[model samples]
Target: MELLAGARIALTPRPVERRHAALEVAMLGHCPGRVRLERLLQLPAALADMRAVGYGQAVDAFSSGAASELYNLPIPLQSSAEFHDIFPDALTATTEYVSLLAGNKAWLGLAVDDFFANGGEKLWVVRIPESAGQAGFLPADATQLHDITTLQGLACVLVIPALGVVGFPDLERLQIPPRLPDIPRVRLENFEPQFLPCTQNTEDDHRERRYSSELSDMPPPWQLPQVLRGMLQYVSSHRPDLQCLFTLPLAYSGELDSPVLDPTALSALSGYQQLPDRAQALRHVQFLFPYLRGPRFALHTPVGLIAGQQAAVARRDGPWRSMAAKPLNTDALPYPRLSIAQTLGLRDKPGISVLNYRNSFSGGAQLSLDDERLVVPALPVADYPVDRQRYDGFCSAEVMRFLGFLRRQLQALGEQLIFNLDYRDPRPRLLLEQFFRRLYSQGALRGASAEQAFSIRESTPQEGAMLYEIMLAPAFPIDRLFLTFANLNGEWRSEVVDG
Candidate 1:
């Protein structure tokens, strides 16, 4: 743990300012250098250091609603002859490789690339002609997606993780992509938004790091191959012996949020009884999960849970993941992975999430504190992580909604929670962040001069602000739990906030 000696420090402005915020001078008197400092990064070499501590790659997350396509290497969604007409030359090359995967394979692959200090390769170049309102899209089943940047340059090859595939040109062939013309002069005016540099690692004092974990307690069966690939990336890039993800089950206090029950909810709970349709209730949900090497956890998704279908990522044989369960008690200290506070601090997220769990923070935070559940509302996007004791202004929408719901479900329950109208939109970082924030704000503007600090970057804006409202749910008990997750929507929204 590298301790900070003073209060303030200065560093250069990141080529990319908004997300990869490396302040010209950072205040670091209290926080240690080795802890939060590792959270920021200016170079790919940082990948090794992160792996050493405990970070993993997130791939193919877009279709799953977790990751987005913008960050993925460009790969065709389909390889059928029918789809080829719309594929770009690069995607065409990528498909050729995926086709080699034995099945009806698709992949992200690259043909020509080379970029270093003087220049970098174009990260994306999709030239699919527009059709009758349809995108040149492919399905998640596609096996391969080309990372053009990784294949084109020696710099990419030099900075690869230990295991996993990195397809560079057959160097013995003595061939490389043509470099862009020399730069005679430089000016801010020449910048084009689409042509912004890829968000790459930088050489800054404040490092920008990323962390990932399986969204659900169990891994989806369909995610096996991708899980294997991710595992390879983790095994090759990181030394998990020193650091890795610490996963609590669906019941663990780490992953879920906890809130007191309202009177109505208490009433409902007292007389709670199930009809016992095990098959229907268990339809597409998983019961257990296995930790496939890497940051992934395998799960047996039921068939009935997929978007349109009732069933989803079910293992071919039977059970999908390989995990058993045990209850979590106070003996468990900091979670297997970063705690909620640590996660918010590291990610620079203004608020926190509890996904769907509403009882994670039921335990007493203090040794002698009352057993009341702690609930706090999510913060606005602008607010950073702070000491819980110091936060009196923030409210936990999740808790209010949960307790409000229990008020109706459970009878005579007493649960108090605050709600906030403010929340920072977690639109996709690269593009969507700007788009939605722009839509909601009176006159938000991307600096006509704003550009990526690194070479590889993707920005995505969500439709929540435009199409629907999105809010964060951070619920802590007044005395017990600190953070919880649950979205008050549909009937719940009407019952909790609207009412």
Candidate 2:
């Protein structure tokens, strides 16, 4: 993970020994601090609630090396949702933040609520593992019909009629008949779940904007546009091989406050055609499109809830235009590796773009029917935030790390060679050339011949130093779309162009 430092050309080899691989990530959320000294002691209890709820694995990513550490901010706040307000300066100063970036063994996930309250802010994410959050209950028997209040603050759940429990949130809209038939149903509510006392108060305390349940203090909304820019800037500069993913809670206000009803959302859902400037959340997401440019992070949220909401709308107002299955910038947000390589006259390089992720089911809730019993499986508590695309990005980074190791090794080996102008002696230039040529022969370069893939030569010694110059045209993966049409018998036939 260490970069080549200083101008010295010789390479230093540190013996490779087995050690914990760095997955250094930090999770920042809110906890009552100095001003709320009374509440400080409750922090452990609150974290205990997080672990009990299913965020144990995610929190373990940071705490596994050491017990999960909690550093209090001097400033006191109502909730971590405002964590976005004290970002950058306040964020970077914390012990947890410092440790994450300073090559420590552990990583963290801090929940500063509603991060990205301001724009043009930046943040770095090391590696926060995903979690399958806490659960709510729904009983199997008809006698427990009136027990909905037991699971009050839950937003959604799986109705394991034979095994588990079911939860609440105005189930009147579901219309269970007088007899309450045992039929399977998938219900996603408009209410945001308020489970963590650290992030938000109980439902009885307030119905204020809420999103996903947090096992620890971390932002519910993933990739806050402004925040994503900051994370991208940090990661691209510090660790291009690593990537980040965001998870947004499915929260709803009044009918008008819902994302499904929002006109700009409607526009985006249609064809990504036009969006109003007023849609701040969607706009924040929109900003990362063809412009932000690299693939270091992916945004993961409960888009299925939004889609379901749209379906509800269709049942009521009739379908307008079909809704978009994903974001308009879905294709554009990934790094355009093929085009860039082509522009640079290099072969296409695959796996250079950021990943795109959509929840198969918002909250990862699914329903299945068993003979006589309507079985709703246990909600995927730890896996809801899981994303494999981000893993692919990590794999790509590991490759880069290996490449860096090889580069350093080559430099070191070359330092052992004699640099001379003698005709019979192989100069440093020849050694470097051999290295790159080997790379090409190993399928690292794109071309039918080494001559097409790269050019390396010994430039005239610069005043007093010898220099070897290399121009490499890396192979790129094909990623362009083209159509060809031919006129035959006064009819036009269209065909896709193959690479």
Candidate 3:
């Protein structure tokens, strides 16, 4: 009876839980604010009921001239189909009359609609002022730079750790004012036109009948570059996890003429010779070019579409996947229809992503991203040795995004364990190992094995601080492929050749 002792057994450890990363975008622009009570009272009963009783705070917080606010897409407002139903009068309100008007000419509404249509899920909106005096495109002085409305919106983003992308759909509008035609007066059938005569007026009577026009000063050529440089510096210094998306201002000779792709204009916008730390600052920004023409709107910027595509890819695949060569989801066409040579010219240039049509395998022409390139300094820093700097990883958008994701995950881990775990604890090292192993298994790291994919080591500790150095081989997308076709021994043969 003593021989029948119970056996002891050990159970298997549970798998480590992975965090779900849902990419979110922050959009700052001039959007319609809360409809006034009087305006609401005048709406149709069905449309009026769309605004729920409990959402007053959110509505007021996002009202015209209000600070930045967060909103979950296709909710509260239900869906894109109900945008007008939820806020009925935003479409018709003009800049001069309404407190907050929908920026139709500026393309704010169109950008929002396009974002959701292209698979964006979460959004943070900042409703800035409409007039030039209240909110200039770029702040005039150092004091005003910190107080810029866009910077205020970015401040809101900093509080939310999950927001990864920031864009200003109306940012280009500040520099390029819309050119409107002059209004003509109609002649009366039976009565002579009467005009008021005053000592102040020196023009003819008919001329006095014309309405006063709004004048917009032409912004300086350096205005946009300076603004972009400031934004990039801010993002690089404060939040390395976030990416700023911008559309290069369209180049045109006259207000009435269509936009053209001017090399000199692009050079002015991207040239960073004046900055001491151009490489560091440029890595945080991605510039898109050549405005698009869609069925819903005549003309629109590419930033909204790029942001949506980035989110969609991050959700479906990993953030490390390249967005290049992906077909655009909207029914838009690249305006000014670039030729093959023109497309190649844009592709050769760095720091810009161009939209162009590519022939698919099925022999159909489909619009797709030619390449996804990050903005990087054309020249190496003078202070550093040429061999010491690695620009290849920074040049690839996918690689930079992967690095950002890695930084965010590591920061979160450190924050969670800072108080409880000791610096020398073996558990922390084991957790990091497990995390990298998971990433490697998911095909995010490029290597034959986990050891080759990544390495983590605790560096020499200083007073009250522990530092860890991590080196990872991030996965990269194929940028080029070569094929050769030849006839050998009266038989045609084709094979892929590596470069």
Candidate 4:
């Protein structure tokens, strides 16, 4: 038997080819630059099948087990979390600064303005009734919402207008500048992927930092903040409940020394550890402590080992408060429709996967399970980085590859599996970057602009979002291939079959 992309089975229309072996989808989008279309062995057929899918989209949507209307949640209105799009995954907007600082303050004002001007839809998020960001800190009047009208006028006048001029309060226009500023705004946001520091090696972190600074365009200490959720705390015996978001360089280890923990970590794990590898350690603990469950997520760094570390301190602002640092349970969140119509808001999204026939488990779009329902696990290789930095040289990644056997098994079993491997957003610095010549980019974009709408977000429209970059953000490009565990006798066997 031979597997085909989209987990579909396409034998050699010949009689001898069908009896020899089967196919499966061992891995999907596992490799970058290249892909393992599928494997074949001792078969009479000359050709086999292949398939693929893309960003915010998956083969599950097209699978026979797919549901039609998974994302049909109840209607909602705007609220506080929407403004500044409170970055659940971003680093501190400002931190360790004796002050919000002149440069930082201006940047803040500019960011809010830009978010609205570009495709940023308003969720009308407001500051808490008693707020967290400002209160007696900046002049009460200075913290005015987006100066939309002024910016819009600045549009052709100050900047460009059609980029959909957006501003807070009531939207307005811009007041163009006279020949642009000498220092064109440079927002070096890195929001999509940063390696979570699993092994807090201070030296290693610094080395990474130095590496970045060497190539930085900001020049000197005028660097951008590191957008990370370090041990951020809110001391509130008297101040308005403050919610601070800060970022530091990936190289900054909380420890002053030991920037790189193990220079030979990849070459020799045990050998590298025992050779007097003394280094300082740093850790980041993120949580909503006393957590609330509307919509919350952190900017997960594409870290190899530093898994997600989070906990919550509930209602610390209100009367009672306590703290706990439990690991996050992703399953608890509502698993909305893992469908294309729902994900892209369009009908008939397609997927293709190659099922390797050789594997024992082959055929079917899904496999029924002993448990009441079959569930897919979270994406593997959680910290697989695929941004500009990670791909600088010959870095190895746990890329997607296809195994023919598993492909056929999924199809025959008729199981609906979830495939959620996020490859969106850059680090905060990159997200906020303005590496362009235009005064205003005409719209919100990370590297370049595109017409893609509907970003994957943690909360409401107000809170910051994991911008759904279009074709530019795919971890795996759209291919007409996929395979399933149709052959699996039960779900347990299916899960264990593939790593």
Candidate 5:
């Protein structure tokens, strides 16, 4: 948005700044009639982040009516204690509101995501144990909580509890450390807004070493195939443009000692060398083609794996000794693989055009002592994995809107540039091609040759209506790095390869 704002300022006249203008932001708190009330909780932090980046005067879709009652205090409520004292009713009101929503099945996953995304200190969700009924309530079961995040198709939920939820007393006992509820230090695993770099694994200083909890949990045995199948189908349905997607195991929590199901056990159960490929896997999604002998890195890590890493490479020992040195094949993985570390690093790199789940704070971070969520001094923001796609797709859509405006203006003047009045005229098609060529000349698309950068093909499927297919190789971010090794004498020199 900041970049777009700058662009808007540069394109408009200097006098335009003097005139009053407003930018309205509208967002959904919940999908109407959906069995989910917690969908909009993550929205708060997202809005906060946007505001910090110069997006202001935006109205909240859910709570705009309450705006008149709210005030921006000169001395901001610095702590929860301050918030409690200033507005005693607010805490209880919020607690009751959360409790009511927490009873629903969707709340278990949505609430955790909301709390983490919003950087809240702690979130407690109470469930009535079946053995005790309504009178004797307890924190939700550990296994149940884990399943809520993993098996229940909520792998996107990041803050999975390391231990079961504990009991909490009334407001009077809240401040006392001993009497307060013992909410477990939930693992900020699986797609954290920030990550530690995997490159410096040898660094002894834990404080200096970086790590990425991008894929924290490993889903249950039966869940892996389902996730892969669904995403693969989605990509396949939207081919060419959506040919490939960056993926991590959405099965289990990385916080768990043993998050994923054993591949050997899976193979034994199925009596096959690899997990059975779904119907979608039988087809390809363009780009590279490789017959995967195993799914080693794909199941266990967030690393990119290619055909070169397959075990079959090791079998053919003629001249290609490097291939022979590779590890034994495990199972066939159908996707273009990269580790979470690599994926995060490429969030802003150029040239690459793959879709990934990475964010601004993937480099390194400090956990807020108050909230236990990632805190980057530069950009204190938290977002879900899908936000990467949303942000990228949004910018592209805005550019398209601008181009559409230009096209509309041309049509109003009866210029046969974007839309040809007569389908038989070759001048409109030539003009359209020249328009895109100008964009390429001005360095709009990502490529060396104009042909590689953009292309326009006219289609007339109907008698009167004309369709134009504008192809562009959108740029991708190189937010990750991989090691490159060169044997210098007896010592191997390592170099970094940007994605």
Candidate 6:
């Protein structure tokens, strides 16, 4: 008889591992022409000189690299202090070329500074090339919109498995002029002439130069809703683990007091109708309002500040902690200040979050996040109730982040065991259960006991894949509080009431 062939064993080595930090953020925007001078210098001598001179002279020169490129900036090492040294095109008081081409105001630079100042540790900057035209600000044409909706515009960011949040600072810049307001003329009619140390050949004289006014016109307000919808959908479908933090475009004529009433307002509560109906898409998007003004910078969107806060909160506590009602550690103040009634109105809106001032015990007013809300739809009535088992967990940003964290952790575990484990192996299941128990011990899950906190079970396998169903009871933040005050027996007393 022929000898039986020994069983063949094909060993599959595990793939290379990549680690991701929690709550990392990616910012996509336009950079000044000085940022690309290094790459231009690598060209032929004649071509390099021509492009450099031409770029300096042009207002909308193509300085950014391909849309797929990402510039990683680690905290402290490559912080704002080293920003100019790293990217020569960065806006500096002495960089005349940047002032001429970019109006001496780079939103990207300000955003980067705000991010680092607010406790952000890791950042990825995606520069939108000038070739994108209006799309570099907000998608204007069909081709531009296609790039965003298809996820090609943010391909570099999306490829990073660890990216937790993303924002488009330049997107809101489309609502305002690129240049800052001109210095107001002062009247010296009533002032008495005084001798001062003045020299006709002062060094400051060489710094004064007229900036270009050929900046691009502000895009129409209607384009905002369309662009936002595309972004929401892109993040939802391609990377559900990520959150898109956005700043609503400012009102065209007046203050953003009543965002729900204006259909043109991108942050309008009613504007959700223009977005995709999928709950997944809506939950992945968040909007902040009114912009902010600080001593170091002019009026700018609060996306950078909020993104930094999210990272800081996630690192200090857990991603499940709510960022609302917490004092921001920045000196920036909200612009077009809203009255108490207006602030309450904004707080009541289900989609938008507002930044407002609160009186602290130290006798000073502090800027704080009023609420943390997602772009989810309103709950349905009991009669025509849809399955909300999944939807309910995503209504809060805190819950959404917790779920994303679990997804990342589970994904990493699976990757590590892909080639080493068998479908029938019990070790993987034990590891998963232990992993959840560890989370429960860490206060991520809420329950009187382990059984109530979470439940894990193997699901029916499909094809060649093993599956598991994990039901989790994540701890939620206290969003509302009730007080009972009554006058009893000639005494006034107040007690906490349960909802």
Candidates' TM-scores? 0.16, 0.29, 0.71, 0.17, 0.27, 0.72
Q: Which is the better candidate, 1 or 6, if ranked by lDDT? A: 6
lDDT of 5 by residue, 6-58 (tens): 57652211111111111111100111121111222223443443344222343
> What lDDT does each candidate get?
0.21, 0.27, 0.58, 0.18, 0.27, 0.59
Residue-level lDDT tens digits of model 6 in 16-75: 222334577878766655553333323233233223322222212333333323222111
lDDT of 1 by residue, 454-491 (tens): 12232335632323222322222232133434566633
RMSD of every prediction: 29.2, 23.8, 14.9, 29.2, 20.6, 13.5
lDDT of 4 by residue, 192-247 (tens): 86676888653422121123223223312211111110111111111111111111
- Which lDDT tens digits does candidate 3 get at residues 217-250? 3333335556665566556766787778776654
Ranking by TM-score: 6, 3, 2, 5, 4, 1
In terms of TM-score, how similar is model 6 to the real structure?
A: 0.72
Error of 1 at 109 (Å): 7.8
Off by over 4 Å in 2: 1-225, 232-427, 460-464, 480-498
Off by over 4 Å in 6: 1-20, 36-78, 93-104, 137-152, 177-222, 254-263, 266-279, 377-394, 462-464, 490-493
Task: Judging by lDDT, tell me the better candidate of 5 and 6.
Answer: 6
Worst 10 residues of 1 by lDDT: 23-32
- Name the weakest run of 10 consecutive residues (lDDT summed) in model 3: 69-78
- Model 4 is weakest, by summed lDDT over 10 consecutive residues, at 23-32
Rate residue 119 of model 5 by lDDT.
22
Of 2 and 5, which scores higher on TM-score?
Answer: 2
Rank all candidate structures by their lDDT, best first, as comma-separated numbers.
6, 3, 2, 5, 1, 4
